[model samples]
Target: MCEEATVSLADVVQEDEQLQEEASAVLAGSDSERCSYPQGYVKRQALYACNTCTPKGGQAAGVCLACSYKCHEGHQLFELYTKRNFRCDCGNGKFADAPCKLFHAKDDVNGLNKYSHNFFGEYCTCRRPYPDPEDQEDDEMIQCVLCEDWLHGRHLGCDVPDHVESWEMICEACMNTHAFLWRYAARLAGKRRENVLRDLTDPPASDPVPGAAVESDAAKETTADETDGATEPSRKRVCPEEAEAKPGCGLEALQNAGAERPGSGAVFWPPGWRSRLCRCDACQASLAAAGLSFLPDESDTVLAYEKKGRSEEGGAPGHDPLMSALDNLSRVQQLEIIHGYNDMKSELKDFLQGFVAEGKVVTSADIRQFFERQQSRKRRRADDRFHCA
Candidate 1:
């Protein structure tokens, strides 16, 4: 019984394979010798209806076969066993499959050709032939003035509704120049107007009206009062809002005002806790006058003493050291310092050149030793002055 069952299954599978082959042949319209099925019998299974049956008309015809659907036309099949494609005859009407031109026609072009249309009507080409210039429907092309590239008149910012005989095109660069100049001229005009307003608001001091004693006498009295005030003492000018808004302006303004006062010749000192914290030039000078030569512990004190010594020696305070260092630096070294160390290896070459030009042996050790000696001397002098003071 098992052997007979295996043989039966094999026969059934063979029959199914034959049926599938026949169905495929019918669907493909390949069996030219075989007649189509009868009116009552189904020929090819209704995978989809024709394009006329769908709401999208022929637009979605290609997509219809992917849907699992059948026509209710009751299996009336027209004969397809010939070279021509077969049609379905039913209650709806006769519906034919789309023609296969490659197989049936003699000189059919492939859809891949540039001139050929796809299954859809979209044109696919790199270069389409230009239309005649004289044609009424043809679009006029404008050549760019600067670049000489052709563009449609509509694209060139033309106002005309229809194409004209003569069309001109200006490239973007030329357009940008015109726009920039217009804006610059408008800005200059605005600045000129602002200057005129400022001049009108503030007249010069010498422009007094002639034969006007009231104005002249008042001006003289004001000048005399100002001169008398200057002899007495100078007052500090402060804006209340600015003083309040900024952190140290109020205190600085007060100090400046006190310095300018007649009787308050007492020097101002920065506020600090200890007696040794005073670091103004006046304080440092007083310390020096009283036989004090030691450097103060604080940096501010050292700076103050240095500035006082430089000033007394008739040199500009804080200027000589910086200028001397800069003068010693070569042009390339100056550029390297300004540009920073993006390429350190390249900058090191320039640094070495400057180092050799300083009339000293150029070595890493020598450079380090020179700076070390300078720092040691400065520290020793500061310590000695502090002890002596």
Candidate 2:
């Protein structure tokens, strides 16, 4: 769309010229030949002039051309072109052909007080005095410690006292320090809560008693194997003090017991412990060093288990297989939770079909490239629309 409506600059210039000519005629005459007013008389109609005759470049005078009120006394009004001195009997004298001081005075007081109209008194035009500097300083000075912006003292929330021995300003640096300290305190509190939860679920190991005992048949089989070996199977065990001993029988026993345990039946006591520990920095670092990282299947299983646990605690009876599948979800898989298992499965199948059709592997880079292409297409479409319009 076009920003501005069509208009000819020539029309505006013509109107301005007409107004200027009318103003000039009203303010015409040499300074010595200008009209005069009685002492203390004020003008009834305001005087105006073109910018060409004004010192500070204004189009109008504050003083009236018809009467003697000091309308332009303190403002930068356009100079009067009268031959005689057109003095203001309101006591400031003639300012006909001179640059008006009304504008400068207005700037000094910021146009808040009616200095020109009231002459610095309450409805008293005969008086002429400037505002007290001490009052201005006390009322208008306030230093902002943060932005260093000066404001009126009365505008500040904290009012000034009668006497201040030592005023400590809270600078921006100090404010930011306070903010950072609060944020750090909140983070520390969260960590401490997490630690407390962990400690409650998994108490410190008091004494390391060997796990569940091996069955008698397993023991007999081991004994028989040792006896049948030619060199007695080297029954020597590695003690803490031993340097060159064989691996411990206890280590072999533990490994055998772990192998015997049913994978599906294995239960983590406080639940969610594995999820927390697995994602921990220390565990991740250790896994990376061992050349193992989390896989999609493992992540899915973990998420499924977590969801099931939450459901069970929330009063849902028995294990839901759908929730179990959800428990083991990877980060991407969790996004599907919003649509439920059946819907997610359907969506995934459709997505996979599309991938196969395109002979492309869906990846982060592919998604980013697609988004960029779409944005470029939108820009092109917009440009086409604009050009056609």
Model 2: how far residue 252 lies from native, Å: 99
Writing each residue's lDDT as its tens digit, candidate 1 over 1-389 gives 56532233335446898775444433432222222222222212222323243322233121111121233234222211111111222221122443322122212222211111111221112112234334465555543322223344444432432222211233343435333212212211112222322222232333121111111222222223223234423323233342223332222323443322222111111111011112344535654664332322221232222223334434324433433666678999977654543344454555556644553445568557655865787699789999998
Model-by-model lDDT, in order? 0.31, 0.32
The CA lDDT at 251 in model 1 is 20
Task: Give each model a TM-score.
Answer: 0.13, 0.15
Compute the lDDT for candidate 2.
0.32
The C-alpha stretches of model 1 lying farther than 4 A from their native spots are 1-7, 28-69, 73-389
> Highest lDDT among the candidates is held by which one?
2
